[model samples]
Target: MLFTPTVIKNLLKKPATRLYPFTVREPFPNYRGELYIDIDACIFCGTCARKCPSQCIEVDKEQGLWSCDPHACVYCGICRDTCPTKCLHMKDVHRKPMTERIMMVEKGEPPKPKKKAAEAAPKAEAEPKADDADKGESKKADAKKK
Candidate 1:
């Protein structure tokens, strides 16, 4: 019969799919699986939040908080790529299946106020003191000469 030969050939071959749960396939190199943050390196600049296509990331600079709604994330890696501190990273393995929705929140030290501007302010204020000293010395020299 026409069907008999085809069915016999299919049955003779091994199953096309593997036992998924029992035998997981290794992920390819550079696979963007799960997104995680290195809280220590994060500056909380909101760059990642701004670059996220899904807008799942939330950054609180004052509070030093970085939170992401994994459920809303598309895992596009834009956030990771745009992070200034290179704190964002992607794991090769996917996130484990979750029954309940949860927010991925990280707490870190807030960015310290830049001291360069503050240091420059004091230097500018000090320069006038030097000029005043030079003026005083010149006045003393003129008086002594007279």
Candidate 2:
């Protein structure tokens, strides 16, 4: 009991606790961090859903959608790799807040029609010259002679 008390007193030289949030640590290069979904690029492929070990990614084709519950994700990065369109990317970002809504594709919304490309301003049409017309006629006469 006497030795334990003496050892404890000496061990408390300085507090080793680090102030988190303020003192951020860099994650490893291979560290699978937060997942970001690019909804527009996603092709409704079920590969992400099938590859997810935790079954966190949900891909409903009939409804044209994919959604993942970050709470259930294990950060394996499988969902990011298996996506064919390269829509899913793993980013080293801050954790999602509880107030953030989960991603889900909306049903019954008609797909927006593709916008017609802007028409390039019409180029000024060249006026046909009398000399050019005469040259064309002579060329045609020469070809007929052959």
Q: Which one is best on lDDT?
A: 1
Between which residue pairs do clashes occur in model 2? none
The lDDT values for all models are 0.83, 0.65
Residue 107, model 2: Cα distance from true site in angstroms: 8.0
Q: Count of backbone clashes for each model?
A: 0, 0
Model 1 weakest 10-residue run by lDDT: 124-133
For model 1, the stretches where C-alpha displacement exceeds 4 angstroms are 1-9, 115-146
| Tens-digit lDDT track of model 1 for 19-65 | 99999988987999899999999987778866777768878766789
Residue 25 in model 2: lDDT? 74
Q: Give lDDT for model 2.
A: 0.65
TM-score of 2: 0.52
Cand. 1 Cα-lDDT = 0.83
